[model samples]
Target: MAGVSRYLAQSIVGTLRQDPTLNPLATLRAWPNLPAEALKRLNQADLSLVDRALEQGGWIWEPTDYPDNLREMESPPLCLFGRGDASALSTPMVAIVGTRKASSYGLAVAEFFGKGLAEQGFIVLSGGALGIDAQAHKGALAAGGRTVAVMGTGPDVAYPAVHKGMFAQMEASGGARVSPFPFGTPSFPSNFPARNPLIAGLAQAVVLVEAPAQSGALQTVAAALDLGRDVFVVPGPITSPAFRGSHGLIRDGATLVEHPMQVVEALGGGMIQPLPPEEGDDLSETQQAILACLNGGPMLTEAIVRQTGLSAPLVLAELTMMELDGIVKKGRDGYQRGL
Candidate 1:
């Protein structure tokens, strides 16, 4: 199907905008690497359906409008479509993402950080899903700050239907709802999995408040890591399955921050920002040893005490506090790390 890859072809077209002498469609047809069969098919293709789809769309982003950070990706969306202020992309952005079925604790954290980040003047970016994503967008709006909702469906289409009013409010309030999909694209479940990275790619950093092991929010982490974006995780209750993936991120050496100011100051102030003492910054030597034991996998109390050469009473006490902090969990089989 490819004499030239879709990405390379799109990149060529995007760059061609700067050249007055070249026509984009003609350049595509003339390229020696463009497959002959593909060109023939495109020529034979009907234009009516394409015209119908464009009617459902809104403003289309010219190549010049693509954010530098996003354009740096191995593969970026060919074009962006949206309503309202696409100018929000020019500002620094921070993504706040989590499970759509977030718990009360997750929702509260998202709200707190969303408002806090926006108040600090960074645009809050998130996938426009319900639960944590919606709450974060609302919190930013409530603080009179700008936010961007990156949607899986078409930019002008509201997928949840319930949030149509909220989307309208966002558009009117200087924020935006945007998508990579065309104007008439459907909100099929498959569309969402690919949308998570757009949230991460647009932002300088990503903050994950909560997610289960299988949460699509984790997809952002993978993309962020690849893009060299720093990821910050908020610790949640170990008893809840909602935080399993979140805690896993923390254990994987992602920074664990308890407040939005930590992220704001860290990003804006760089090394000069003397962050206040947070729980994660003060791990005791005993706690370190205990974590080392559990890092391999779940183990019984006897195994932990034996492995660390610590008395049962001390190990038991440390485990109790760690469990309370949601750093670890105890199951019927053994004590292990938790969300």
Candidate 2:
């Protein structure tokens, strides 16, 4: 029986390798249940191939029996490839996913949630897509924490060519890239919806930063609810199409999240202390003056000079310090108080 299970697992993987769109669920469901299916799938592959490709890439298994909750679903994937530590999946995980074309506001939320979640020891799960997904992964990485990048493509295939560097960085940082797809599969639109389920399922809750009505991130929210996970939507400018979907989700009963700590509390971590706002709290006099100039909002260099009453060289030095302190935000427009 064990041998048969291994054969099935191997065959499924091999088939998917050649064509990821092959009905993996069909093949999986045929195997009595997910556990037996996973065992067979693994046995079908070369031991070395499985070892090398998935050593740290998590597992594809079914629970021994239908977990009552999961079994009640329409048709759960026969098996799933869990990257990183599965135990981490069971921990308080928050899925921070949003638009691939995100606004600065979206980026800020992703970073804030990533850092806050990591600091509180909760794992962050997200697709490894560019934009918001990348920002979320980066946020967690920047905080020296573990995150999981669930892939729509193969773990070995970095979907956006440019993110190869980011992908390598993620693996190097004790984070893991995961996918239900086998090695070397190119990304497909269909695969993304398939991948969304895992991202939503693995997390205790889902956080939508900025998603357009048609965005794939919203699909993740649907999956989260189906999996019985909590869903939180960050409200954004109602006028922005980027926020349309999130607002709709909120109207439909998704929780609203104004801060990362809200997500932390939702996951049972309770309220969190934001790293003390150090801008004014620990600033040198010079730094304070620069901030004072920018506090009115974005300012031109000349405007800053007039406001601070400081020489160009002096103002530049102070502004640099304030920038380094994260007290000021910089952009093409000019500098402003870091929101």
Candidate 3:
């Protein structure tokens, strides 16, 4: 309670009076006087445990240390618990979210955008859920860049449990996992919607990779729009139900992005320019042929092989190398020249 102001303590008491549960935003909204029981409950919280966890895993921060973008939110969290580099929270960020039940195409789009944006010095932010979110985090880590996973549970907890390794890697790579919730909080269904606003608040923009009509990703999009964050959607085939929400977003005026650079350019505020090829970065003959195949636009591996008369395996190998070399990028649609 050291950092808790008199007004905040009063608000917490007020919120508990209405519903025994603590609702941070509601507390901020109604600053009623502290009732005896609520005040006792507030005083009884185990501050020692929170302090030990903060000292052991990471640091705790108030609004002063929060990212300026997040702090501007109408109902920002009073305190944040974070692991890894706290500085990353202040950096320009892009949130990429989609269905937990993502398709291969959706995963690829998430990874492509995740890597592309991170390479340009933007921190990739996501929910750390499976499918698209996991791939997004993987892509940023693969690029040797930073990413921040805004959790729906406690900062110390990896909700799905499968992502504990990822949570460690993020911190090791100078990225972070953050939460507004206290330590030991479980991944309750209610926590996610509450967590969505933080994801939107931390980002300059939000990208919906592939969301179905009833997807949770759409909820994040709503929060992003409410926060005045730019929203971008990756268009998908009309035949696919997975794209229904994204297409609707496009129709409603969210920018449609076929490539990650479009998102970068759209959110421009001194974003780093794409690096020029280094000296002696000349392409081999096969590489040149593959590049030519993609000159028209992004093309599938099979299409590139057919156009360049290269074998399928050879094309795949070459494309993989090119992607690592930053010569080309692979998206849900296919491969295109890197930005």
Candidate 4:
């Protein structure tokens, strides 16, 4: 079995070196000792059919180099089908994963980590699943920082399909969509468990925002433990089933993370200077007005309009611009100072 593991690992590395378009996991799962029975029950399928479907979807496969560091991670995916520059994968990254059915609190925590990590110069990683994962990716990209989506399905096909535009936007903004499965690989239940390890391997740590007792997100926590990487969980309402798995992990010894700073402190001594306080780009007058409105705590757009004397339309436009500039965030009721 050790021989099989080593060979399987080597096979992926070798495949990545040759066919840049190849997704090692999809093809390599065919090997003799790949825990196929378990994965098969999970409904995993090969990518041969997926490749053809993507051709009709107008997707293109582009090869990019993986950093020597990433290639050296324990059993890294054979190759990743990337929608943008693969180099973004090499950035210091932290994985933020959680339940698909998330509470409002859980979603907020995910976004906090996303924006915080991006500001701290850490690339954010997530599965691009709905709920928590989606919020995290949105926050990171909103921070104007690098983010990578590791898919359980093919990079060409957004699994939920609802995230299709988000995926394209990420790629266009120098962020990337990556997969260990070939194009058109329908997101099988089985594919995600296998995909968990890849996410754990890519990150320095895995953060479980909110996981139900039987959630697949737990698989990632387990993989992180196996890989000797740190695992962190945000404390949620004790009564919430969404927090059951995470609480179990904490009881078993995962770090309890509340603020995003805790994560940064865990990664290194402390957060490095995140995105510079200000980029060289000059702020527009309207953007300046909006920032002025957020003098202290989170502020609503109505308050901003009243304070800035700007119309709602003008205030909203400036707010969007500030969000893209990484200056502000939309909170539960309104906008707030973002990381």
**lDDT tens per residue, model 4, 1-339:** 112454656665576768978665565555555665535632455546555644544233322355654554576665566567566777788999999998767776787789888878888899999998998998798788878888888777777889988888788777887787666666677677778888887788888889999998998888888878889898877888878999999999899987677888987857444352463246667776777777677888788889888888667656754664467878797898777
Q: Give me the candidate number with maximum lDDT.
A: 3
Tens-place lDDT digits, model 3, residues 1-339 = 323454765466455767867654445334456465445545544556576777777788877787679877887877788888999988889999999998767776788789888888899999999988999999899889999998988788877899999999999999998987776566767778778889999999999999999999898899899989999998877999998999999999999887778887787744444563543356778988888787789898888888889887667756765675578888999999987
What local lDDT score does residue 192 receive in model 3, on the 0 to 100 scale?
Answer: 84
> What is the C-alpha local distance difference test score of each model?
0.80, 0.72, 0.82, 0.75
Q: What's the lDDT for candidate 1? A: 0.80
Error of 4 at 206 (Å): 1.4
The estimated TM-scores of all candidates read 0.67, 0.68, 0.72, 0.66
User: What does candidate 1's lDDT look like per residue over 216-327, in tens digits?
Assistant: 9999988999999989999988898889999999999999988778898779643332333344456679987888888778999999999999988778767755664466
lDDT, model 3, position 139: 85
Backbone clash count, each prediction separately: 2, 11, 0, 1
lDDT of candidate 2 over 1-339, digit per residue (tens): 123444555666577778877655565556455576345544553445445656656465454432343444454555555454544445556789999998766776777678768878877889988888888888788778778888987677778988888877777766767676665556666778877877776677888989999998988888888878889888888889889999999999999987778877877777855543566685667667777777667887677888777887666545643543357767887888875
Question: Quick one: ranking by TM-score, best first?
Answer: 3, 2, 1, 4
TM for candidate 1 is: 0.67
lDDT of 1 at 310: 95
